[model samples]
Target: MRLLLASLILLVFIPLNAQTTRKYSNEFMNIGVDAAALGQSNAVVARSNDVNAGYWNPAGLINLEDNQLALMHSSYFANIANYDYAGFAMPLDDNSAFGVSLIRFAVDDILDTTQLIDEQGNVNYDRISLFSTADYGLTVSYSRNLPIQGLSYGVNAKIIRRIIGDFASSWGVGLDAAIQFETDNNWKFGVMARDITTTYNSWSINEEEFAKVQNAVEGQNQELPETTEITIPKLQIGVAKLYRFHYDYTLEAEIDLNVRFEQNNDVISTSFASINPAFGFEFGYIDMIYLRGGMGNFQNELQIDNSEQLTFQPTFGVGFKYNGIQVDYAFTDIGDQSVALYSNVFSLKLDFSIFR
Candidate 1:
């Protein structure tokens, strides 16, 4: 009875902060990739034109002029969780490009307390063990120009693998499609269909390990555990344009709309689909130094009085590019509508043509 009561208490507090499989399946993949993109609140769907575009809007990969490599790292909750990304892109021909990207999000050194109690019903600190939970994603992307001038299309095939120590594991697969069009005036339009085929994950749980957890709880035993998760498709559309000024100054501004076919807490919701808008802009000096800012992730939060309020996230960042090496940094917050928790993100991009 003591272990059962203690396990019930742990259940209420532990899983609340851990990765869950119920809703938002494969959510780590949606955390965004590059620092430049996240710095601008992921409003770069129309202007992603380098290696990082492999995870943003692959169609923009068609604009790659030289082979490129990108890497980024970010941590959350005072280094409790870590997120990392790496990508490579190259122009295959004058009108085609190819890229590949890898992403990982993990929380390590978690204590497993299910076995902390001995057979004599006494607390045994030495019996506790440590474990980790991690998720990984690998994406391969390709883009090519269409017969129509200034029009390009792209596709992505994604593989998802997840592990929860020795307790559970899963494997998933998904596909994405995207298109980009540029007008004579340098205006760009882009659309991306994420998980167009409805990604599916099949879980495999270790019965022996799970039995320890089951015995700890009071009445968690069920006939069958959930073994599958499905991720529905979503759409993102964006428009952007660049402005050139005297003395080699430039400005780029973009807006993106994310659409999901379900009722949620998005800023714009209806019986059909909900839409959330993001706005971002970049200022450049001589095409070498850049300043970026954005606002996004608008949601309707309920208050104590049952009233709803609109809230959003704001971000800013800076970048320097010299001799084919680019360094970027962003001050970000992932808090939706609660107490703010801020973190720092850094990324680097290398242009292989510089060495050649």
Candidate 2:
């Protein structure tokens, strides 16, 4: 009970900080099969490769020499659901590259809502229900090298959509921009701003049925039906620095802070802030295999408030590359109190590149 109360207090007292809403869109956008494998940390931005660069730092694509394509899939929370990602990058010239990517986050069958009444007051009969929520996006990006120094910049435009049941669907647009710089000492810095202009179209509310139910209980007749178009705010800001050490080993750290801003969106209810800071270290062995591990929202720092609070635990993973192909995986444990989740998350990623 004490833990529950603390969770509630933390949820309620938390102030608005991050500036985005429909976190599902953001989460769905960030999910990566290899992101976990590379340290489950946000710091990998400075170590971008040809394929994963689409998500980490599109600017990194300028470093690629050949046309490359990659695909990745992840099993989230063990079996509760899954996400799939695919991308392709092609070098337009020595200093520029273009890429496109698709991402999908899907959950399994869920209980369907059925209206019911019982003699005991108010209740509904439990029945097997089927439903699912999904988010997907298509992004096109271009990256170019700056002429003055070891710097690069890139931009991506995304088409986003979400589906909930047969009656509800929302669509929106978002964009991301990134900058990267490297130094002679093997130090790198990266900055990214994502979802700069994201907004949802609107959701359906079955006004006729809602009115019938409301009138039956309140004994009041309503003449007009109104629907609300809720606008979720755009999010901003992510930065990271990476340092190379000895023995082909490197350390990278990243911090991402964002907020959910929405009005009339019941799921989120109120404005909330989240700070996700992660650290990762990657070591190369024989110049072919890479082992990485990191912790996120370190120590259950990221929180969501509702009747039940949800907190994420530290996550870790690793990766391997050989003969122009890279394979990655990650593991995550939600915690013990989670009813539907305890030990969960098995992810896999594949990346390929060719040099000209």
Candidate 3:
């Protein structure tokens, strides 16, 4: 465990050549996957004990009790954008696990108006066309025991793909490392390092499409766009605990500190890094029916007088489990940004042991 921790630290802090950190580059992946997580403002790092762990905290995958499959779908901005996810995970043995996850977010049916004014400047509605832009993430993860009871480590290999109809596309790769530890008292702690090695995306633009758009307007498309994008490393630290009101009633609460290496709108602002804290809890009756809620994304908004006032996003959700199948729902904000649109998210999980 000591060696593993040391290596992860080294990788996270190591300097890279030509580092190009940008705000919200490949940001779609951060929108989150499962609805249970979205409800808690993505604070499930410490207790994600199922297939969904592949994205939250891979180390938690070690806690899975059976082979599992998961699926989710969500829409944002009045259904203009759609997000989808799918994952599969299974325990390889008593001390190890493996999982794979795929996520996609897209905006479709966008009108292309470049050719609207044909050669003679005639108003031709028939020239209008449609296109779509999408972003995708694929992650393969592995978790293993750390030779210490209740302690485990995990790693993820990721592939990122972005597309804009036939005009442009990009491909990138990155890595993540995480750890989770549980105590006998039902206290769980976890840390996840996202894009720990710095992710890079190289884009290819279609000159044919560029020419059409450039000629559409005299003053536009004057220069070639930057084809490279970079995503800096981020960290999430979480702690959670479970309490029982009785033999059949229970509650679990979790708190997470999400950190980004660059300053942003987080309430805890700093030039080096900013921190956002999220709190969430779940109440369960026999672990079959559940209710969840949370609040997060605190920000200091500048008012008319330049004075800052605090604001936060609130979320709610409900879940049900029966016969090895579980369904969850959440009404929450899209990403950590204080977007007013609260999207509805749904996810399904199935345990393969039911077949036995």
Candidate 4:
């Protein structure tokens, strides 16, 4: 473990410059909520050691000895609360590992309102109405070590749902895959692919909003219209490398590139390709205390339209381990030098194990 700690310090001070390019949709709603999944966002990723390897990289979990479970939460930008993730892994009798995990992203108490206009095209504030929105996802995953000497693999399937303030509710499915390679020298290589389907669903406007708008149309007293389908983002790919230092510390770096491709590629915009690069260091004292720091692009969106508004240039976190259990936390801020939408985020995680 001391070797892992040394690697963490070396990577931070070494100043090795690297650049990554990726394709991603600059959409605000999608980016803000799923930020954590793009990479191993919690400090627990470091403290739990190889327990989260199925979500981060299945191959990494191959080296684990204890059975474990964990939960994590993120306070997102724009007054939104992101998801919670839980995972468990156990060692088989033949030196193999098996694990399962569930992930859920949810938001509550969102304000739903409508635009009010006066007859003379002036302002009308008295007519505004309020409602709320809700979105959630549930993912289940399984992973195991391969018979191959140094390979591991895992997969996750999910169901997603969205409701926009008495408007409409939509549902969709998603899948994620991960693989990892480890060498005797404590070096590891990993890859993950997420949202392979480019999930799609639709929601109707709030009933109140729809009625207000419909009534405003000069001669139309029409019935409420049908809901519309909204498309989410597309496939995302991530690659990472880890070097273990002395003790139980590690230095890891990863890059995630996402792209949006529709059935009609000709109309697709080049901006669909977006990228996020993560460089992080984890320090562990024995098998318990941990400290982490990382810097990355595309961690959060500060502006609704400017994709460059991705904040979280640097992040720091800490974790505690006791009796085969772990707790983690991370803090992030958006140095939005140019907008009122500037914000900060906090995340927490807990891990427990039942040895079998």
Please name the candidate that would achieve the greatest TM-score relative to the true structure: 1
Q: What is the TM-score of each candidate against the true structure?
A: 0.93, 0.69, 0.92, 0.62
* True-structure lDDT of candidate 3: 0.86
* Residue pairs clashing, model 3: none
Shift of residue 121 alpha carbon in model 2, Å:
15
Query: lDDT of each model, Cα atoms only?
Result: 0.86, 0.58, 0.86, 0.49
Candidate 4: segments with Cα more than 4 A from true spot: 1-54, 58-66, 78-83, 86-107, 110-131, 202-209, 216-274, 298-312, 334-356
Between candidates 2 and 4, name the one with more favorable lDDT. Answer: 2
Looking at candidate 3, what is the lDDT of residue 230? Answer: 86
- lDDT at 113 for candidate 2? 34
Write candidate 3's Cα lDDT for 30-149 as tens digits.
888888888888889999889999999999999988999999999987787789999999999999999999999987777777688888889899998877778999999999999889
Q: Kindly give the number of clashing pairs for every candidate.
A: 0, 5, 0, 17
Q: Which ranking of candidates, highest TM-score first?
A: 1, 3, 2, 4
Cα displacement (angstroms), candidate 3, residue 153, comes to 0.7
**Model 4 lDDT per residue over 118-187, tens place:** 6677667775554434456555556567877666776666666765445455665666676766666545
Q: lDDT at 122 for candidate 3?
A: 98
Better of 3 and 4 by TM-score: 3
lDDT of 1 by residue, 48-132 (tens): 8899988888998999999999999999877778999999999999999999999999877777788788889999999988777
State the number of backbone clashes in model 1.
Answer: 0
